[model samples]
Target: MEEEIRVEFTKNGFDFDEEEVILKKCLSFCINYKLSASDIVSSWDVYSLNRGLELTVRSSHMGAFLEQLQNEQLNKVREKESGLHLYSNDVAMILDGEYEEVKEDMLDTPTSKPASANKQPSDSTGKISGSKFSSGKPQESVTPFGQRKSKFAVQSSLNENHIKQIVKVEDHTNSEDDIIKRVRPNQKCTMRIMSSQPKPGCRFMYDRIDDKFNFLENRIKKQAISYVSAGICDEPSDPSIASQKSIFAVGMICCEEEGRLKEKPVLLQSSVEHSGGQRVRLDFQKLNQFSVFPGQVVGVEGLNPSGHCLIASKIIDYVPLSVDSSDDHPSKRQAMDQNLQMTNLSLDVPELSLIVAAGPFTTSDNLFFEPLNELLAYARRKQPQLLVLLGPFIDSDHPELKKGYMNCTFDELFQLEILGKLRDYVEYMGSAVHVILIPSIRDANHDFIFPQPAFDIHPADFNHQIHSTPNPGTFCANEVKVACCNVDILKHLSAEEIFRNPQGGSKHRMTNLAKHVINQCSFYPLYPPAEDVPLDYSLAHEALHILSVPDILILPSDLAQFVKVLSLEARNEGERQIKCICVNPGRLARGEGGGFFAEINYKGNPDSSSASIIRI
Candidate 1:
């Protein structure tokens, strides 16, 4: 069998001269599992090997053998791509792969050369020669939305073009020195816990059915009335009142039954309680283009002659932004002026830099927080005025945690492993660097509820530099109102969303997901939250609402990280559309390796602001 496997591998262009032992092991395992040597060899190629192999064999031994082969193949790719060596046993487990036991050690060491050292320098046009951070130089100013620019191509050296541009902007004013002098080294900023907490005498319980129903009704009314006033839809009427002829009706889309998402009948419930508060079955066979998720308040034009079914001819999702306005609209200009004034009054300088990262701080293989440490080191180097870190600080789903393999309690592990490192970080960076910590539902050491309380850590020795906020937290930094939520809403929405026209346009799915969040004006707007999320409907009324559109919305998700400028038009005409920067700074750790974070230099305007997604 080994001989046959060798012959098949040779025919398939596999070079196993230096891996005879591994080749033999693979052959024996394949034979034992009744896997065809020819079939296995056919799946082997230069491209497949370089990209990494994912083969399923019958047993654990076969999995280990395949992992070894994958490691060798990945090494070949790495060597060809960067002339770097991947030592044996330096296997990184594919986070989304089938095998759970395979752990890959991160090969990038502290002594490794910086990414910028290999690159040639470029001119002062904010471009870097031989840099892979971006495909091309970013515009001298911000590019308009819909242009797909690379998000994660940051240079290792501090002298990159972004730094140069910021320095040039700073050089035009003589206020830098004065601003630095005004900011005391160890000053602590106050952090307000935005989400409502259950008081001492209140009973803790899940949302009642009535409360949940009322919440959805309120949301539908607010959105339906906005559409009517905007002239997008006629005055709202009960769906049951519509005749067989074409008519317009405003209602909320929902499934007929709960916990049944696939191939289930969809119903449209009218906004008005009068006319018996009717629900009409929706028929979508005629609509040309549409995307609808449960709990969406939409305007539909169709015929409901029988008062039982509405055959929808057109679906009108509320327009997120008006295309009529330019980047320099008069209302926008006025708002910018106001922001500048507020910024000047709030701080010593008009500009502020911020670093944002979300956690599962430790890698999958072990409890060592190499990624978190590297992030803090980078933060210290940048010395941003504010650092925002979102959680699952003590991730509840970690392999070690799930297996119950630990020497101490969950709280002890949190204090020693999570907070200890943070305490040291703030102490080293000094009090001028404000640290904002937001909790998550998956955090083991904290409350498991959705509208969670802030971490109650009172270190007598350290100053109030470390600020803890609730799960869906909000705060102000240098006049910028920042709102952040740690739930993976993108994944939740994507899984449950039904798009009638999947290939409709050039708009990215992520952009549409963000638009839904902003238009709905709620943190977790999905009616029936994902099972993993612990949502409390009572507190959700006050806690989940976005009081006003925030300047920046930080929604960390399991989806691909993105930094986008979302422009939302106001309901009133002639008023400027609200513009927001939405960022999902991915997780800090993916499996057993470092991931990415974001940095922003806000100068009171989205166009003038500069931001980047950098790998740890």
Candidate 2:
């Protein structure tokens, strides 16, 4: 333990040349307090943070720092005796960056006696045993003000598969089975990653966002035109202008205030050219059932009787896609199938195995990164062809980070703790293994924006085996194209969206949220983007657009972890009915306990793919 303390001090910029006094004090504190070496190091950081000074290398300042820490320990005892509890309001005070205000309030108020004198002392890790402090406790589950989540029961399924193999990603399509191709190791990596919208540390104009929104409106209108030609939708009219007769209109769905979409306040903001980005309240009382959220571009057939509101008769949430004409030519397909059998040909396709995990990689109770280390261990053992890691690697919301307890810059922390292990993993695993690192807006070390840019890596760290993509980016692993965005869009949408007669339970309701992203062709279709998401509308057109529907869409969230297969209702001439697998590999660490990851094996089509959610 003494050696560990010495090493920690050295890492924190202390050297044994004249720092033995500091090391001894740290050791003594650890022994006296029953804190681990890591805890002692964390204490030093907290002490420095509170003092508003860099950690002193000189032992001359050590006494004051240790004194402050000792005081904090005494305060904890007082808190325990008083049985102080932090209600939601107390949490809000910290989130609002009013720490001084909270301190003043505490000073003015007297510590009250315990509500229950019978209450025993709480464990140090709150509830979890063997826990240590992380930077700060960032509320992963708390939604921003105005964005409130209503209680809805999810038809339980993900819970049943906890710690068990879901086994296979089966294609339930009624079509005949396709030909099987044998799996083999690839000579070179064919994985293609696309992350072009925004560059790291780049600047974007706040004005261009309006233009981008205008452009998106036009884009959706163009898409709707095809439906118009197919007689599926009538030509769109301006919902902004007064129209009493039933008219089909197209526009983006939005909430009037900075809150959830209830029935009355729903607004449809039309394209610039049509209604000049004007918004008209939408009355959904006429429609029996529908789901609506911000940013969802829809073609609605409705009457605008008062010119102030559009009473929707029917809502077309997404444009339709047609399957290829070959389905219309069954005989020709059968002949081609026979010809393949007669030729006795072989099409050796590469089968892919993937391991995907999302972040908050460390358990909430500590910065040990035990969960991440374990995940890496699992990846090393599995040796999957591809490993996808989503970020907030160093979560900005952690309680330690929130309270300014860190001793290092986020970048240095990432390089040392995150990339260091990854570097070793790649070196040991060799080039055969590929890793994809996608950043989140919540990653403190990275740029902060939706369609977030990739993390800037050192030139030395830029190896072929590891790749970085923007948040809400896409890539191909062999023939499987994947779209991944780290934001908890599921939670965001759930908080904001309003639905009625949702055919499926909350599980399917969650899937509908995923559907909104694909249908709108944007990674985050919720308009008035969630309070936490710093969505620069300027880059949104390019960054948010989904050029092609990926085979796998990874939308990680606080919601239940599940692997689901979703199919499109529309069919396009060139493309078949689009079907993709959506996987939410929950967080690697859920609060203090372990969370989940996804193991995937795909042999070309949805029919041959298999996926499961497993506990870490």
Q: What lDDT score belongs to each candidate, Candidate 1 first?
A: 0.63, 0.66
**Model 2, 1-616: lDDT tens per residue?**
7788876555443344356676787778888878876567656544543233433455776788678678778866754664432221011223324544543553464577655323321211222122222333233343121121321122223223421343222222213232221122323456787767688777744646457656566566655664565566566688877765788887888877764454237788877666777899888778777888777888888888778989998988775543111123646645764674453244765467788899997765456566677788877655577889999787776555554444445665577668877888877666677889999877767666677888777536537777898887888777568899888887777656666655364336656778888876668777676776777777766777776667889999876677877777644455445677888888887666777888877655555567777777
* Top model number, lDDT: 2
Name the weakest run of 10 consecutive residues (lDDT summed) in model 2.
121-130
Taking the tens digit of each residue's C-alpha lDDT, what string does model 1 give over 250-356? 77778888842323678888764534557889988897667777777788888888878889998876633332112255577468657754754674543567888
Candidate 2 lDDT for residue 614: 74
Displacement of residue 608 (Cα, Å) in model 2 is 2.4
- Angstrom error at residue 555, model 2: 0.5
Poorly placed runs, candidate 1 (over 4 Å): 1-164, 167-193, 197-203, 228-234, 244-248, 259-262, 275-277, 284-287, 313-350, 461-463, 500-507, 569-573
